[model samples]
Target: MSTRTETDSMGAIEVPSKAYWGAQTQRSKENFAIGHQPMPLAVVHALAHIKKAAARVNANLGELPTDIAQLIEQAADEVIAGELDQHFPLTVWQTGSGTQTNMNVNEVIAGRANEISGQTRGGKSPVHPNDHVNRAQSSNDCFPTAMHIAVLQAVTLHLTPAIKTLRDGIDQQAKRYEKLVKTGRTHMMDATPVTFGQELSAFVAQLDYAQTAIDNSLPAVCELAQGGTAVGTGLNSSPGFAEAIAKELAQLTELPLRSAPNKFAALAGHEPLVTLSGAIKTLAVTLMKLANDLRLLGSGPRAGLAEVHLPANEPGSSIMPGKVNPTQCEALSMLACQVIGNDTTISIAASQGHLQLNVFKPVIVHNLLESIELLADGCVNFQKQCIAGMTANEQQMAAHLENGLMLVTALNRHIGYDNAAKIAKKAYEDNQTLRQAALDLGLVTDEQFSQWVRPEDMLQPE
Candidate 1:
């Protein structure tokens, strides 16, 4: 885009004659055919933050003479406000060099700046967009900074709120269904009695711990590598410029942002990215566990243990009529698996950061942003479809609890272990109820038996 105002002589169908990203966009379109899910919104947020910070910095310095800087700022504001999306063109796929993306941002900003100045589309003269606006910055620092800023922004804006909604729904259910008895299962077999609320409360605990795990990493998330320049040496940056720029970014983003203590380490490796990715993977683990529970609880209306019912999203099958599937639960499980896999990609990519800079940024951002987006979307859907609509089947729960062989646990408290074993075995063989067999053998008096068989007492142990 910083080149000429035209497309590559040989690339995709000509959609528009105007050019800013110039031949790079055309070349990218022709080369990488990766599907368009759109660049991550975190990436968008980051770019906007860059524009805002630049404009504010220029304002503070009051030295930028041309109207171009101000105009580029306005265009960036439009992009942030959800307008002019077509203009932010660049393929998600490119060579690891990031030339296409850097040029893409540079040209778009420069051209829009030119437009504001009533100049030609490809002109950068009056303000020299890259020189004046992107002054003292490098793609290496900006992209990684954007990645951190974007992730932190999402955790604050979207992920945290969604997780709260999810946790609150389950927490309410835990309290609401605390009195409802259900058959607890382990290894796909009925184990003992438990309150349906208690089982749900376990998931609530998982969500809480996961929330804590993510929240605990906020400090690391806030630390940034903005001053790292091309290789973290603070190369052309002035003394305190890094700090001032970081402060400007913090003000613009409203995040607790800071410059990294060791710019060298920040640039030479991506350990922080790997750590954050692991945190995200931990969240996926929590979600997968929650989804598995919901799926199991909603397993069957007929043959399976239907302890809780989930809202039917659609006709479960085209061929099998009258069957409903746990679509939301399934989606969450799938997303969790994908996120876990994304973390692996992130880990590998971050670890492979060669000597000075990592060429793996595009891939790292791709995986990290995608993982976060899925997490946000999945949590919102899971809360709405699965958790909100889930209902405790009190009758089914009571029946399962009453009919299970786990009631033998109560017999052990009343009679000796040997006597309880004998009673359970005889009841199994005789096809008689534990109470009936107990009465026949006098292992428990009828009054004692009537007093001791409370499921609540069995689960809570007094």
Candidate 2:
């Protein structure tokens, strides 16, 4: 490939002629050949938003020339539109502070801006990366600010809506099964009678509570760390730079973003992200339980519980004849496990913040974004493939309900607890119905047993 020499503070390097990144980006790319997990484009777009807002704010404050600021804004807009995606090649494993990725964005925007202004892409002539594009900002602040913006947008625009869609779909299933009475299990054994609708509604309630927790954790994520340049002193930044930039970013992203009240804490501690991760983890746990329950309820057609029929998206076995599996639920459960693991990574990374800055910002944000995307996509896929087409096995449910020993629970208030237990034991021992056992044991008349052992009556309080 053709190459061009690009210069930065650390001398010069040969960059791909077609590439828009500069010397620092090239150096970082060559040095950190660790993993293939590239920095999230969401974060890159967020950084572009920050640079555009910063440029406009700097120009308005008379800190940067209007033409230069406009050029940076144009390039940043292109990045935000994903026109320059190939230019940002840094990985998440580079520089935990995310400085390399930040510079990669800065360099790409500068090179593109320079090219737009009738200059070559290598040299920082018409639009220097640092002075013109990244003016009045430090990687320390820009990275965390970008992290917050990316996470906030992703959760708001993707994860939350996906969760709502799935929750609503499950709720519809619940309503459809509301009157279908089934046997309930406790400790993996028959316990009592419940409507299939009630069982599914519990999943709906869990999702609602988890989504509320995720929503509640977002306001803190809206606090940006942009103006806390270097070490949070706002040393070289103009007086109103922080507030002005926050306002500009809010307008650009249509989020209720604001400058952090304590720049020091914003730069040093990533408590907001940790809190959001915890909430996402809770959602993952809820999803895990829901998926497992669905899997169990839909376990088999002949050999297992088979209380419900999951969508048979694909054939389950290669050797077995005519079998299907709960692939969507399995996939969703695995994704939940991954998100839960990502939460652990985020928690550990967040706790490593030393004095003025957290060097684990990249890992923290990477795991957080990964969890959000996984959950969002997982929910959509599970809803479309599994929950939307799920059906209740009403006949099987009724059969289970009729055969359950726990229905003897209904006889407690009438025949006394000891008599009820004796009747249940006798029925189980003789493989007889509760009414027959009660009649044989002389515990109650058939009419009395019928009146006392109604499963539907036991569904609610007397």
Candidate 3:
């Protein structure tokens, strides 16, 4: 492989001639080749924003030359646009503090800035990575700040919209099926009759709660850890450096960003991220329930309780001919499972902090971002491929309603619970429906039976 020598404080190292990274990034890359998955694009974008805003802020404070700052901003903008993505080649396993990835970004932006300034790639003269690009910032502060920015941007751009789409789709289904009465099951056995709209409305409400949870955590997520340069002391940074960076970042990303109120707590803990992860897990739980219920309701066309018909996107079996399956529900269920597992990882990582610095930032950010992306994308796919095309099997639902012995539940309010149970028992013993059994048992006339046990009226008595 083609290589060139670059030097850091640790002295000389060889980097790929084509790579924009420098000595430290190259050394760290060699040290940790554990995972193929690079740090997420959202993270890279957030880092770019951080670097760009830092350069601009430093320049305004007379800490850096304006020309150099403009060049760094230009290069950082390319990174933000994903034009220089191939330049950042470090994995998530490099440094627990994510210092390696931060340096990787710094090196790439410096190299690009150097290129713009008409200098050699590895030469750190005009746009030195640490002195200029990463001025007044430490990996400790920048990484956690980037974590918050990435997650916040991801939730705003993807998760919220996707969840809204799913909730609205469910609401539309509920409105369409407002009058469609179906057998409601408890403990996998027929218990009572409920309108299809009412069942779907429950899922709608769940998504609403999940969305609210995510929304509530946004304020905490907006608090950034950037100002606390090293160990939350803000020692080397100029006064107002943190606040200025926050303002620049907020203006650049169009997000409501702010300086961390307590740099010590921000540097040492990841409470906001943990809270957000919990909210994401809640969404995953709701999704799992929704998907499983859909699968059960659309189980079999010939044998099982096939009340709702899901979109048949794929074949159920390799051998079974002409068998369709709920592929979207399966995908959603699998994603939900993954998100739940990611929450465990995030919680553990969040707790691993030891005073003034959490070394597990990379893992936390990686897992948290993955969870958000999976649920967001999964919701979009499920909504389009499954929910949008789903239909109610009115005939099948009607057949189940007629055959379900639980319909006698409505009669309990009028004819006493004992008589209702007896009528249900008689229907079961004689292999007759409730209507037929009620007529033979002299419980009531046809008109009275119909009036007392109407499924439509059973929905909402008051």
Residue ranges of candidate 3 with Cα displaced over 4 Å? none
Query: What TM-score against the true fold does each predicted structure earn?
Result: 0.90, 0.99, 0.98
Candidate achieving higher TM-score, 1 or 3 = 3
lDDT of each residue in 319-343, candidate 1, tens digit only: 9999999899889999999999999
Instruction: TM-score winner between 2 and 3, please give it.
Output: 2
Top lDDT hit = 2
lDDT score, candidate 2, position 323:
88
Q: What is the C-alpha local distance difference test score of each model?
A: 0.74, 0.92, 0.91
RMSD of 1: 3.3
lDDT of 3 by residue, 1-462 (tens): 999899999999989898899999988888898979898878888999999999999999999999999999999999999998887788888788889889888999999889888887756878999999899999999999999999999999999999999999999999999899998999999878899999999999999999999999899999999989889989779899999999999999999999999998898899999999999999999999999999999999888888889987778889999999878888899999999999999999999889888999999999999999999999888889999999999999999888999989988877889988988999999999998898898887899897888777777754
Model 2 lDDT per residue over 291-368, tens place: 999999999889999988898888999999898988888899999999999999999999998999899999998999
List the lowest-lDDT window of 10 residues for candidate 2. Answer: 450-459
Q: Where in model 2 is the C-alpha error above 4 Å? A: none
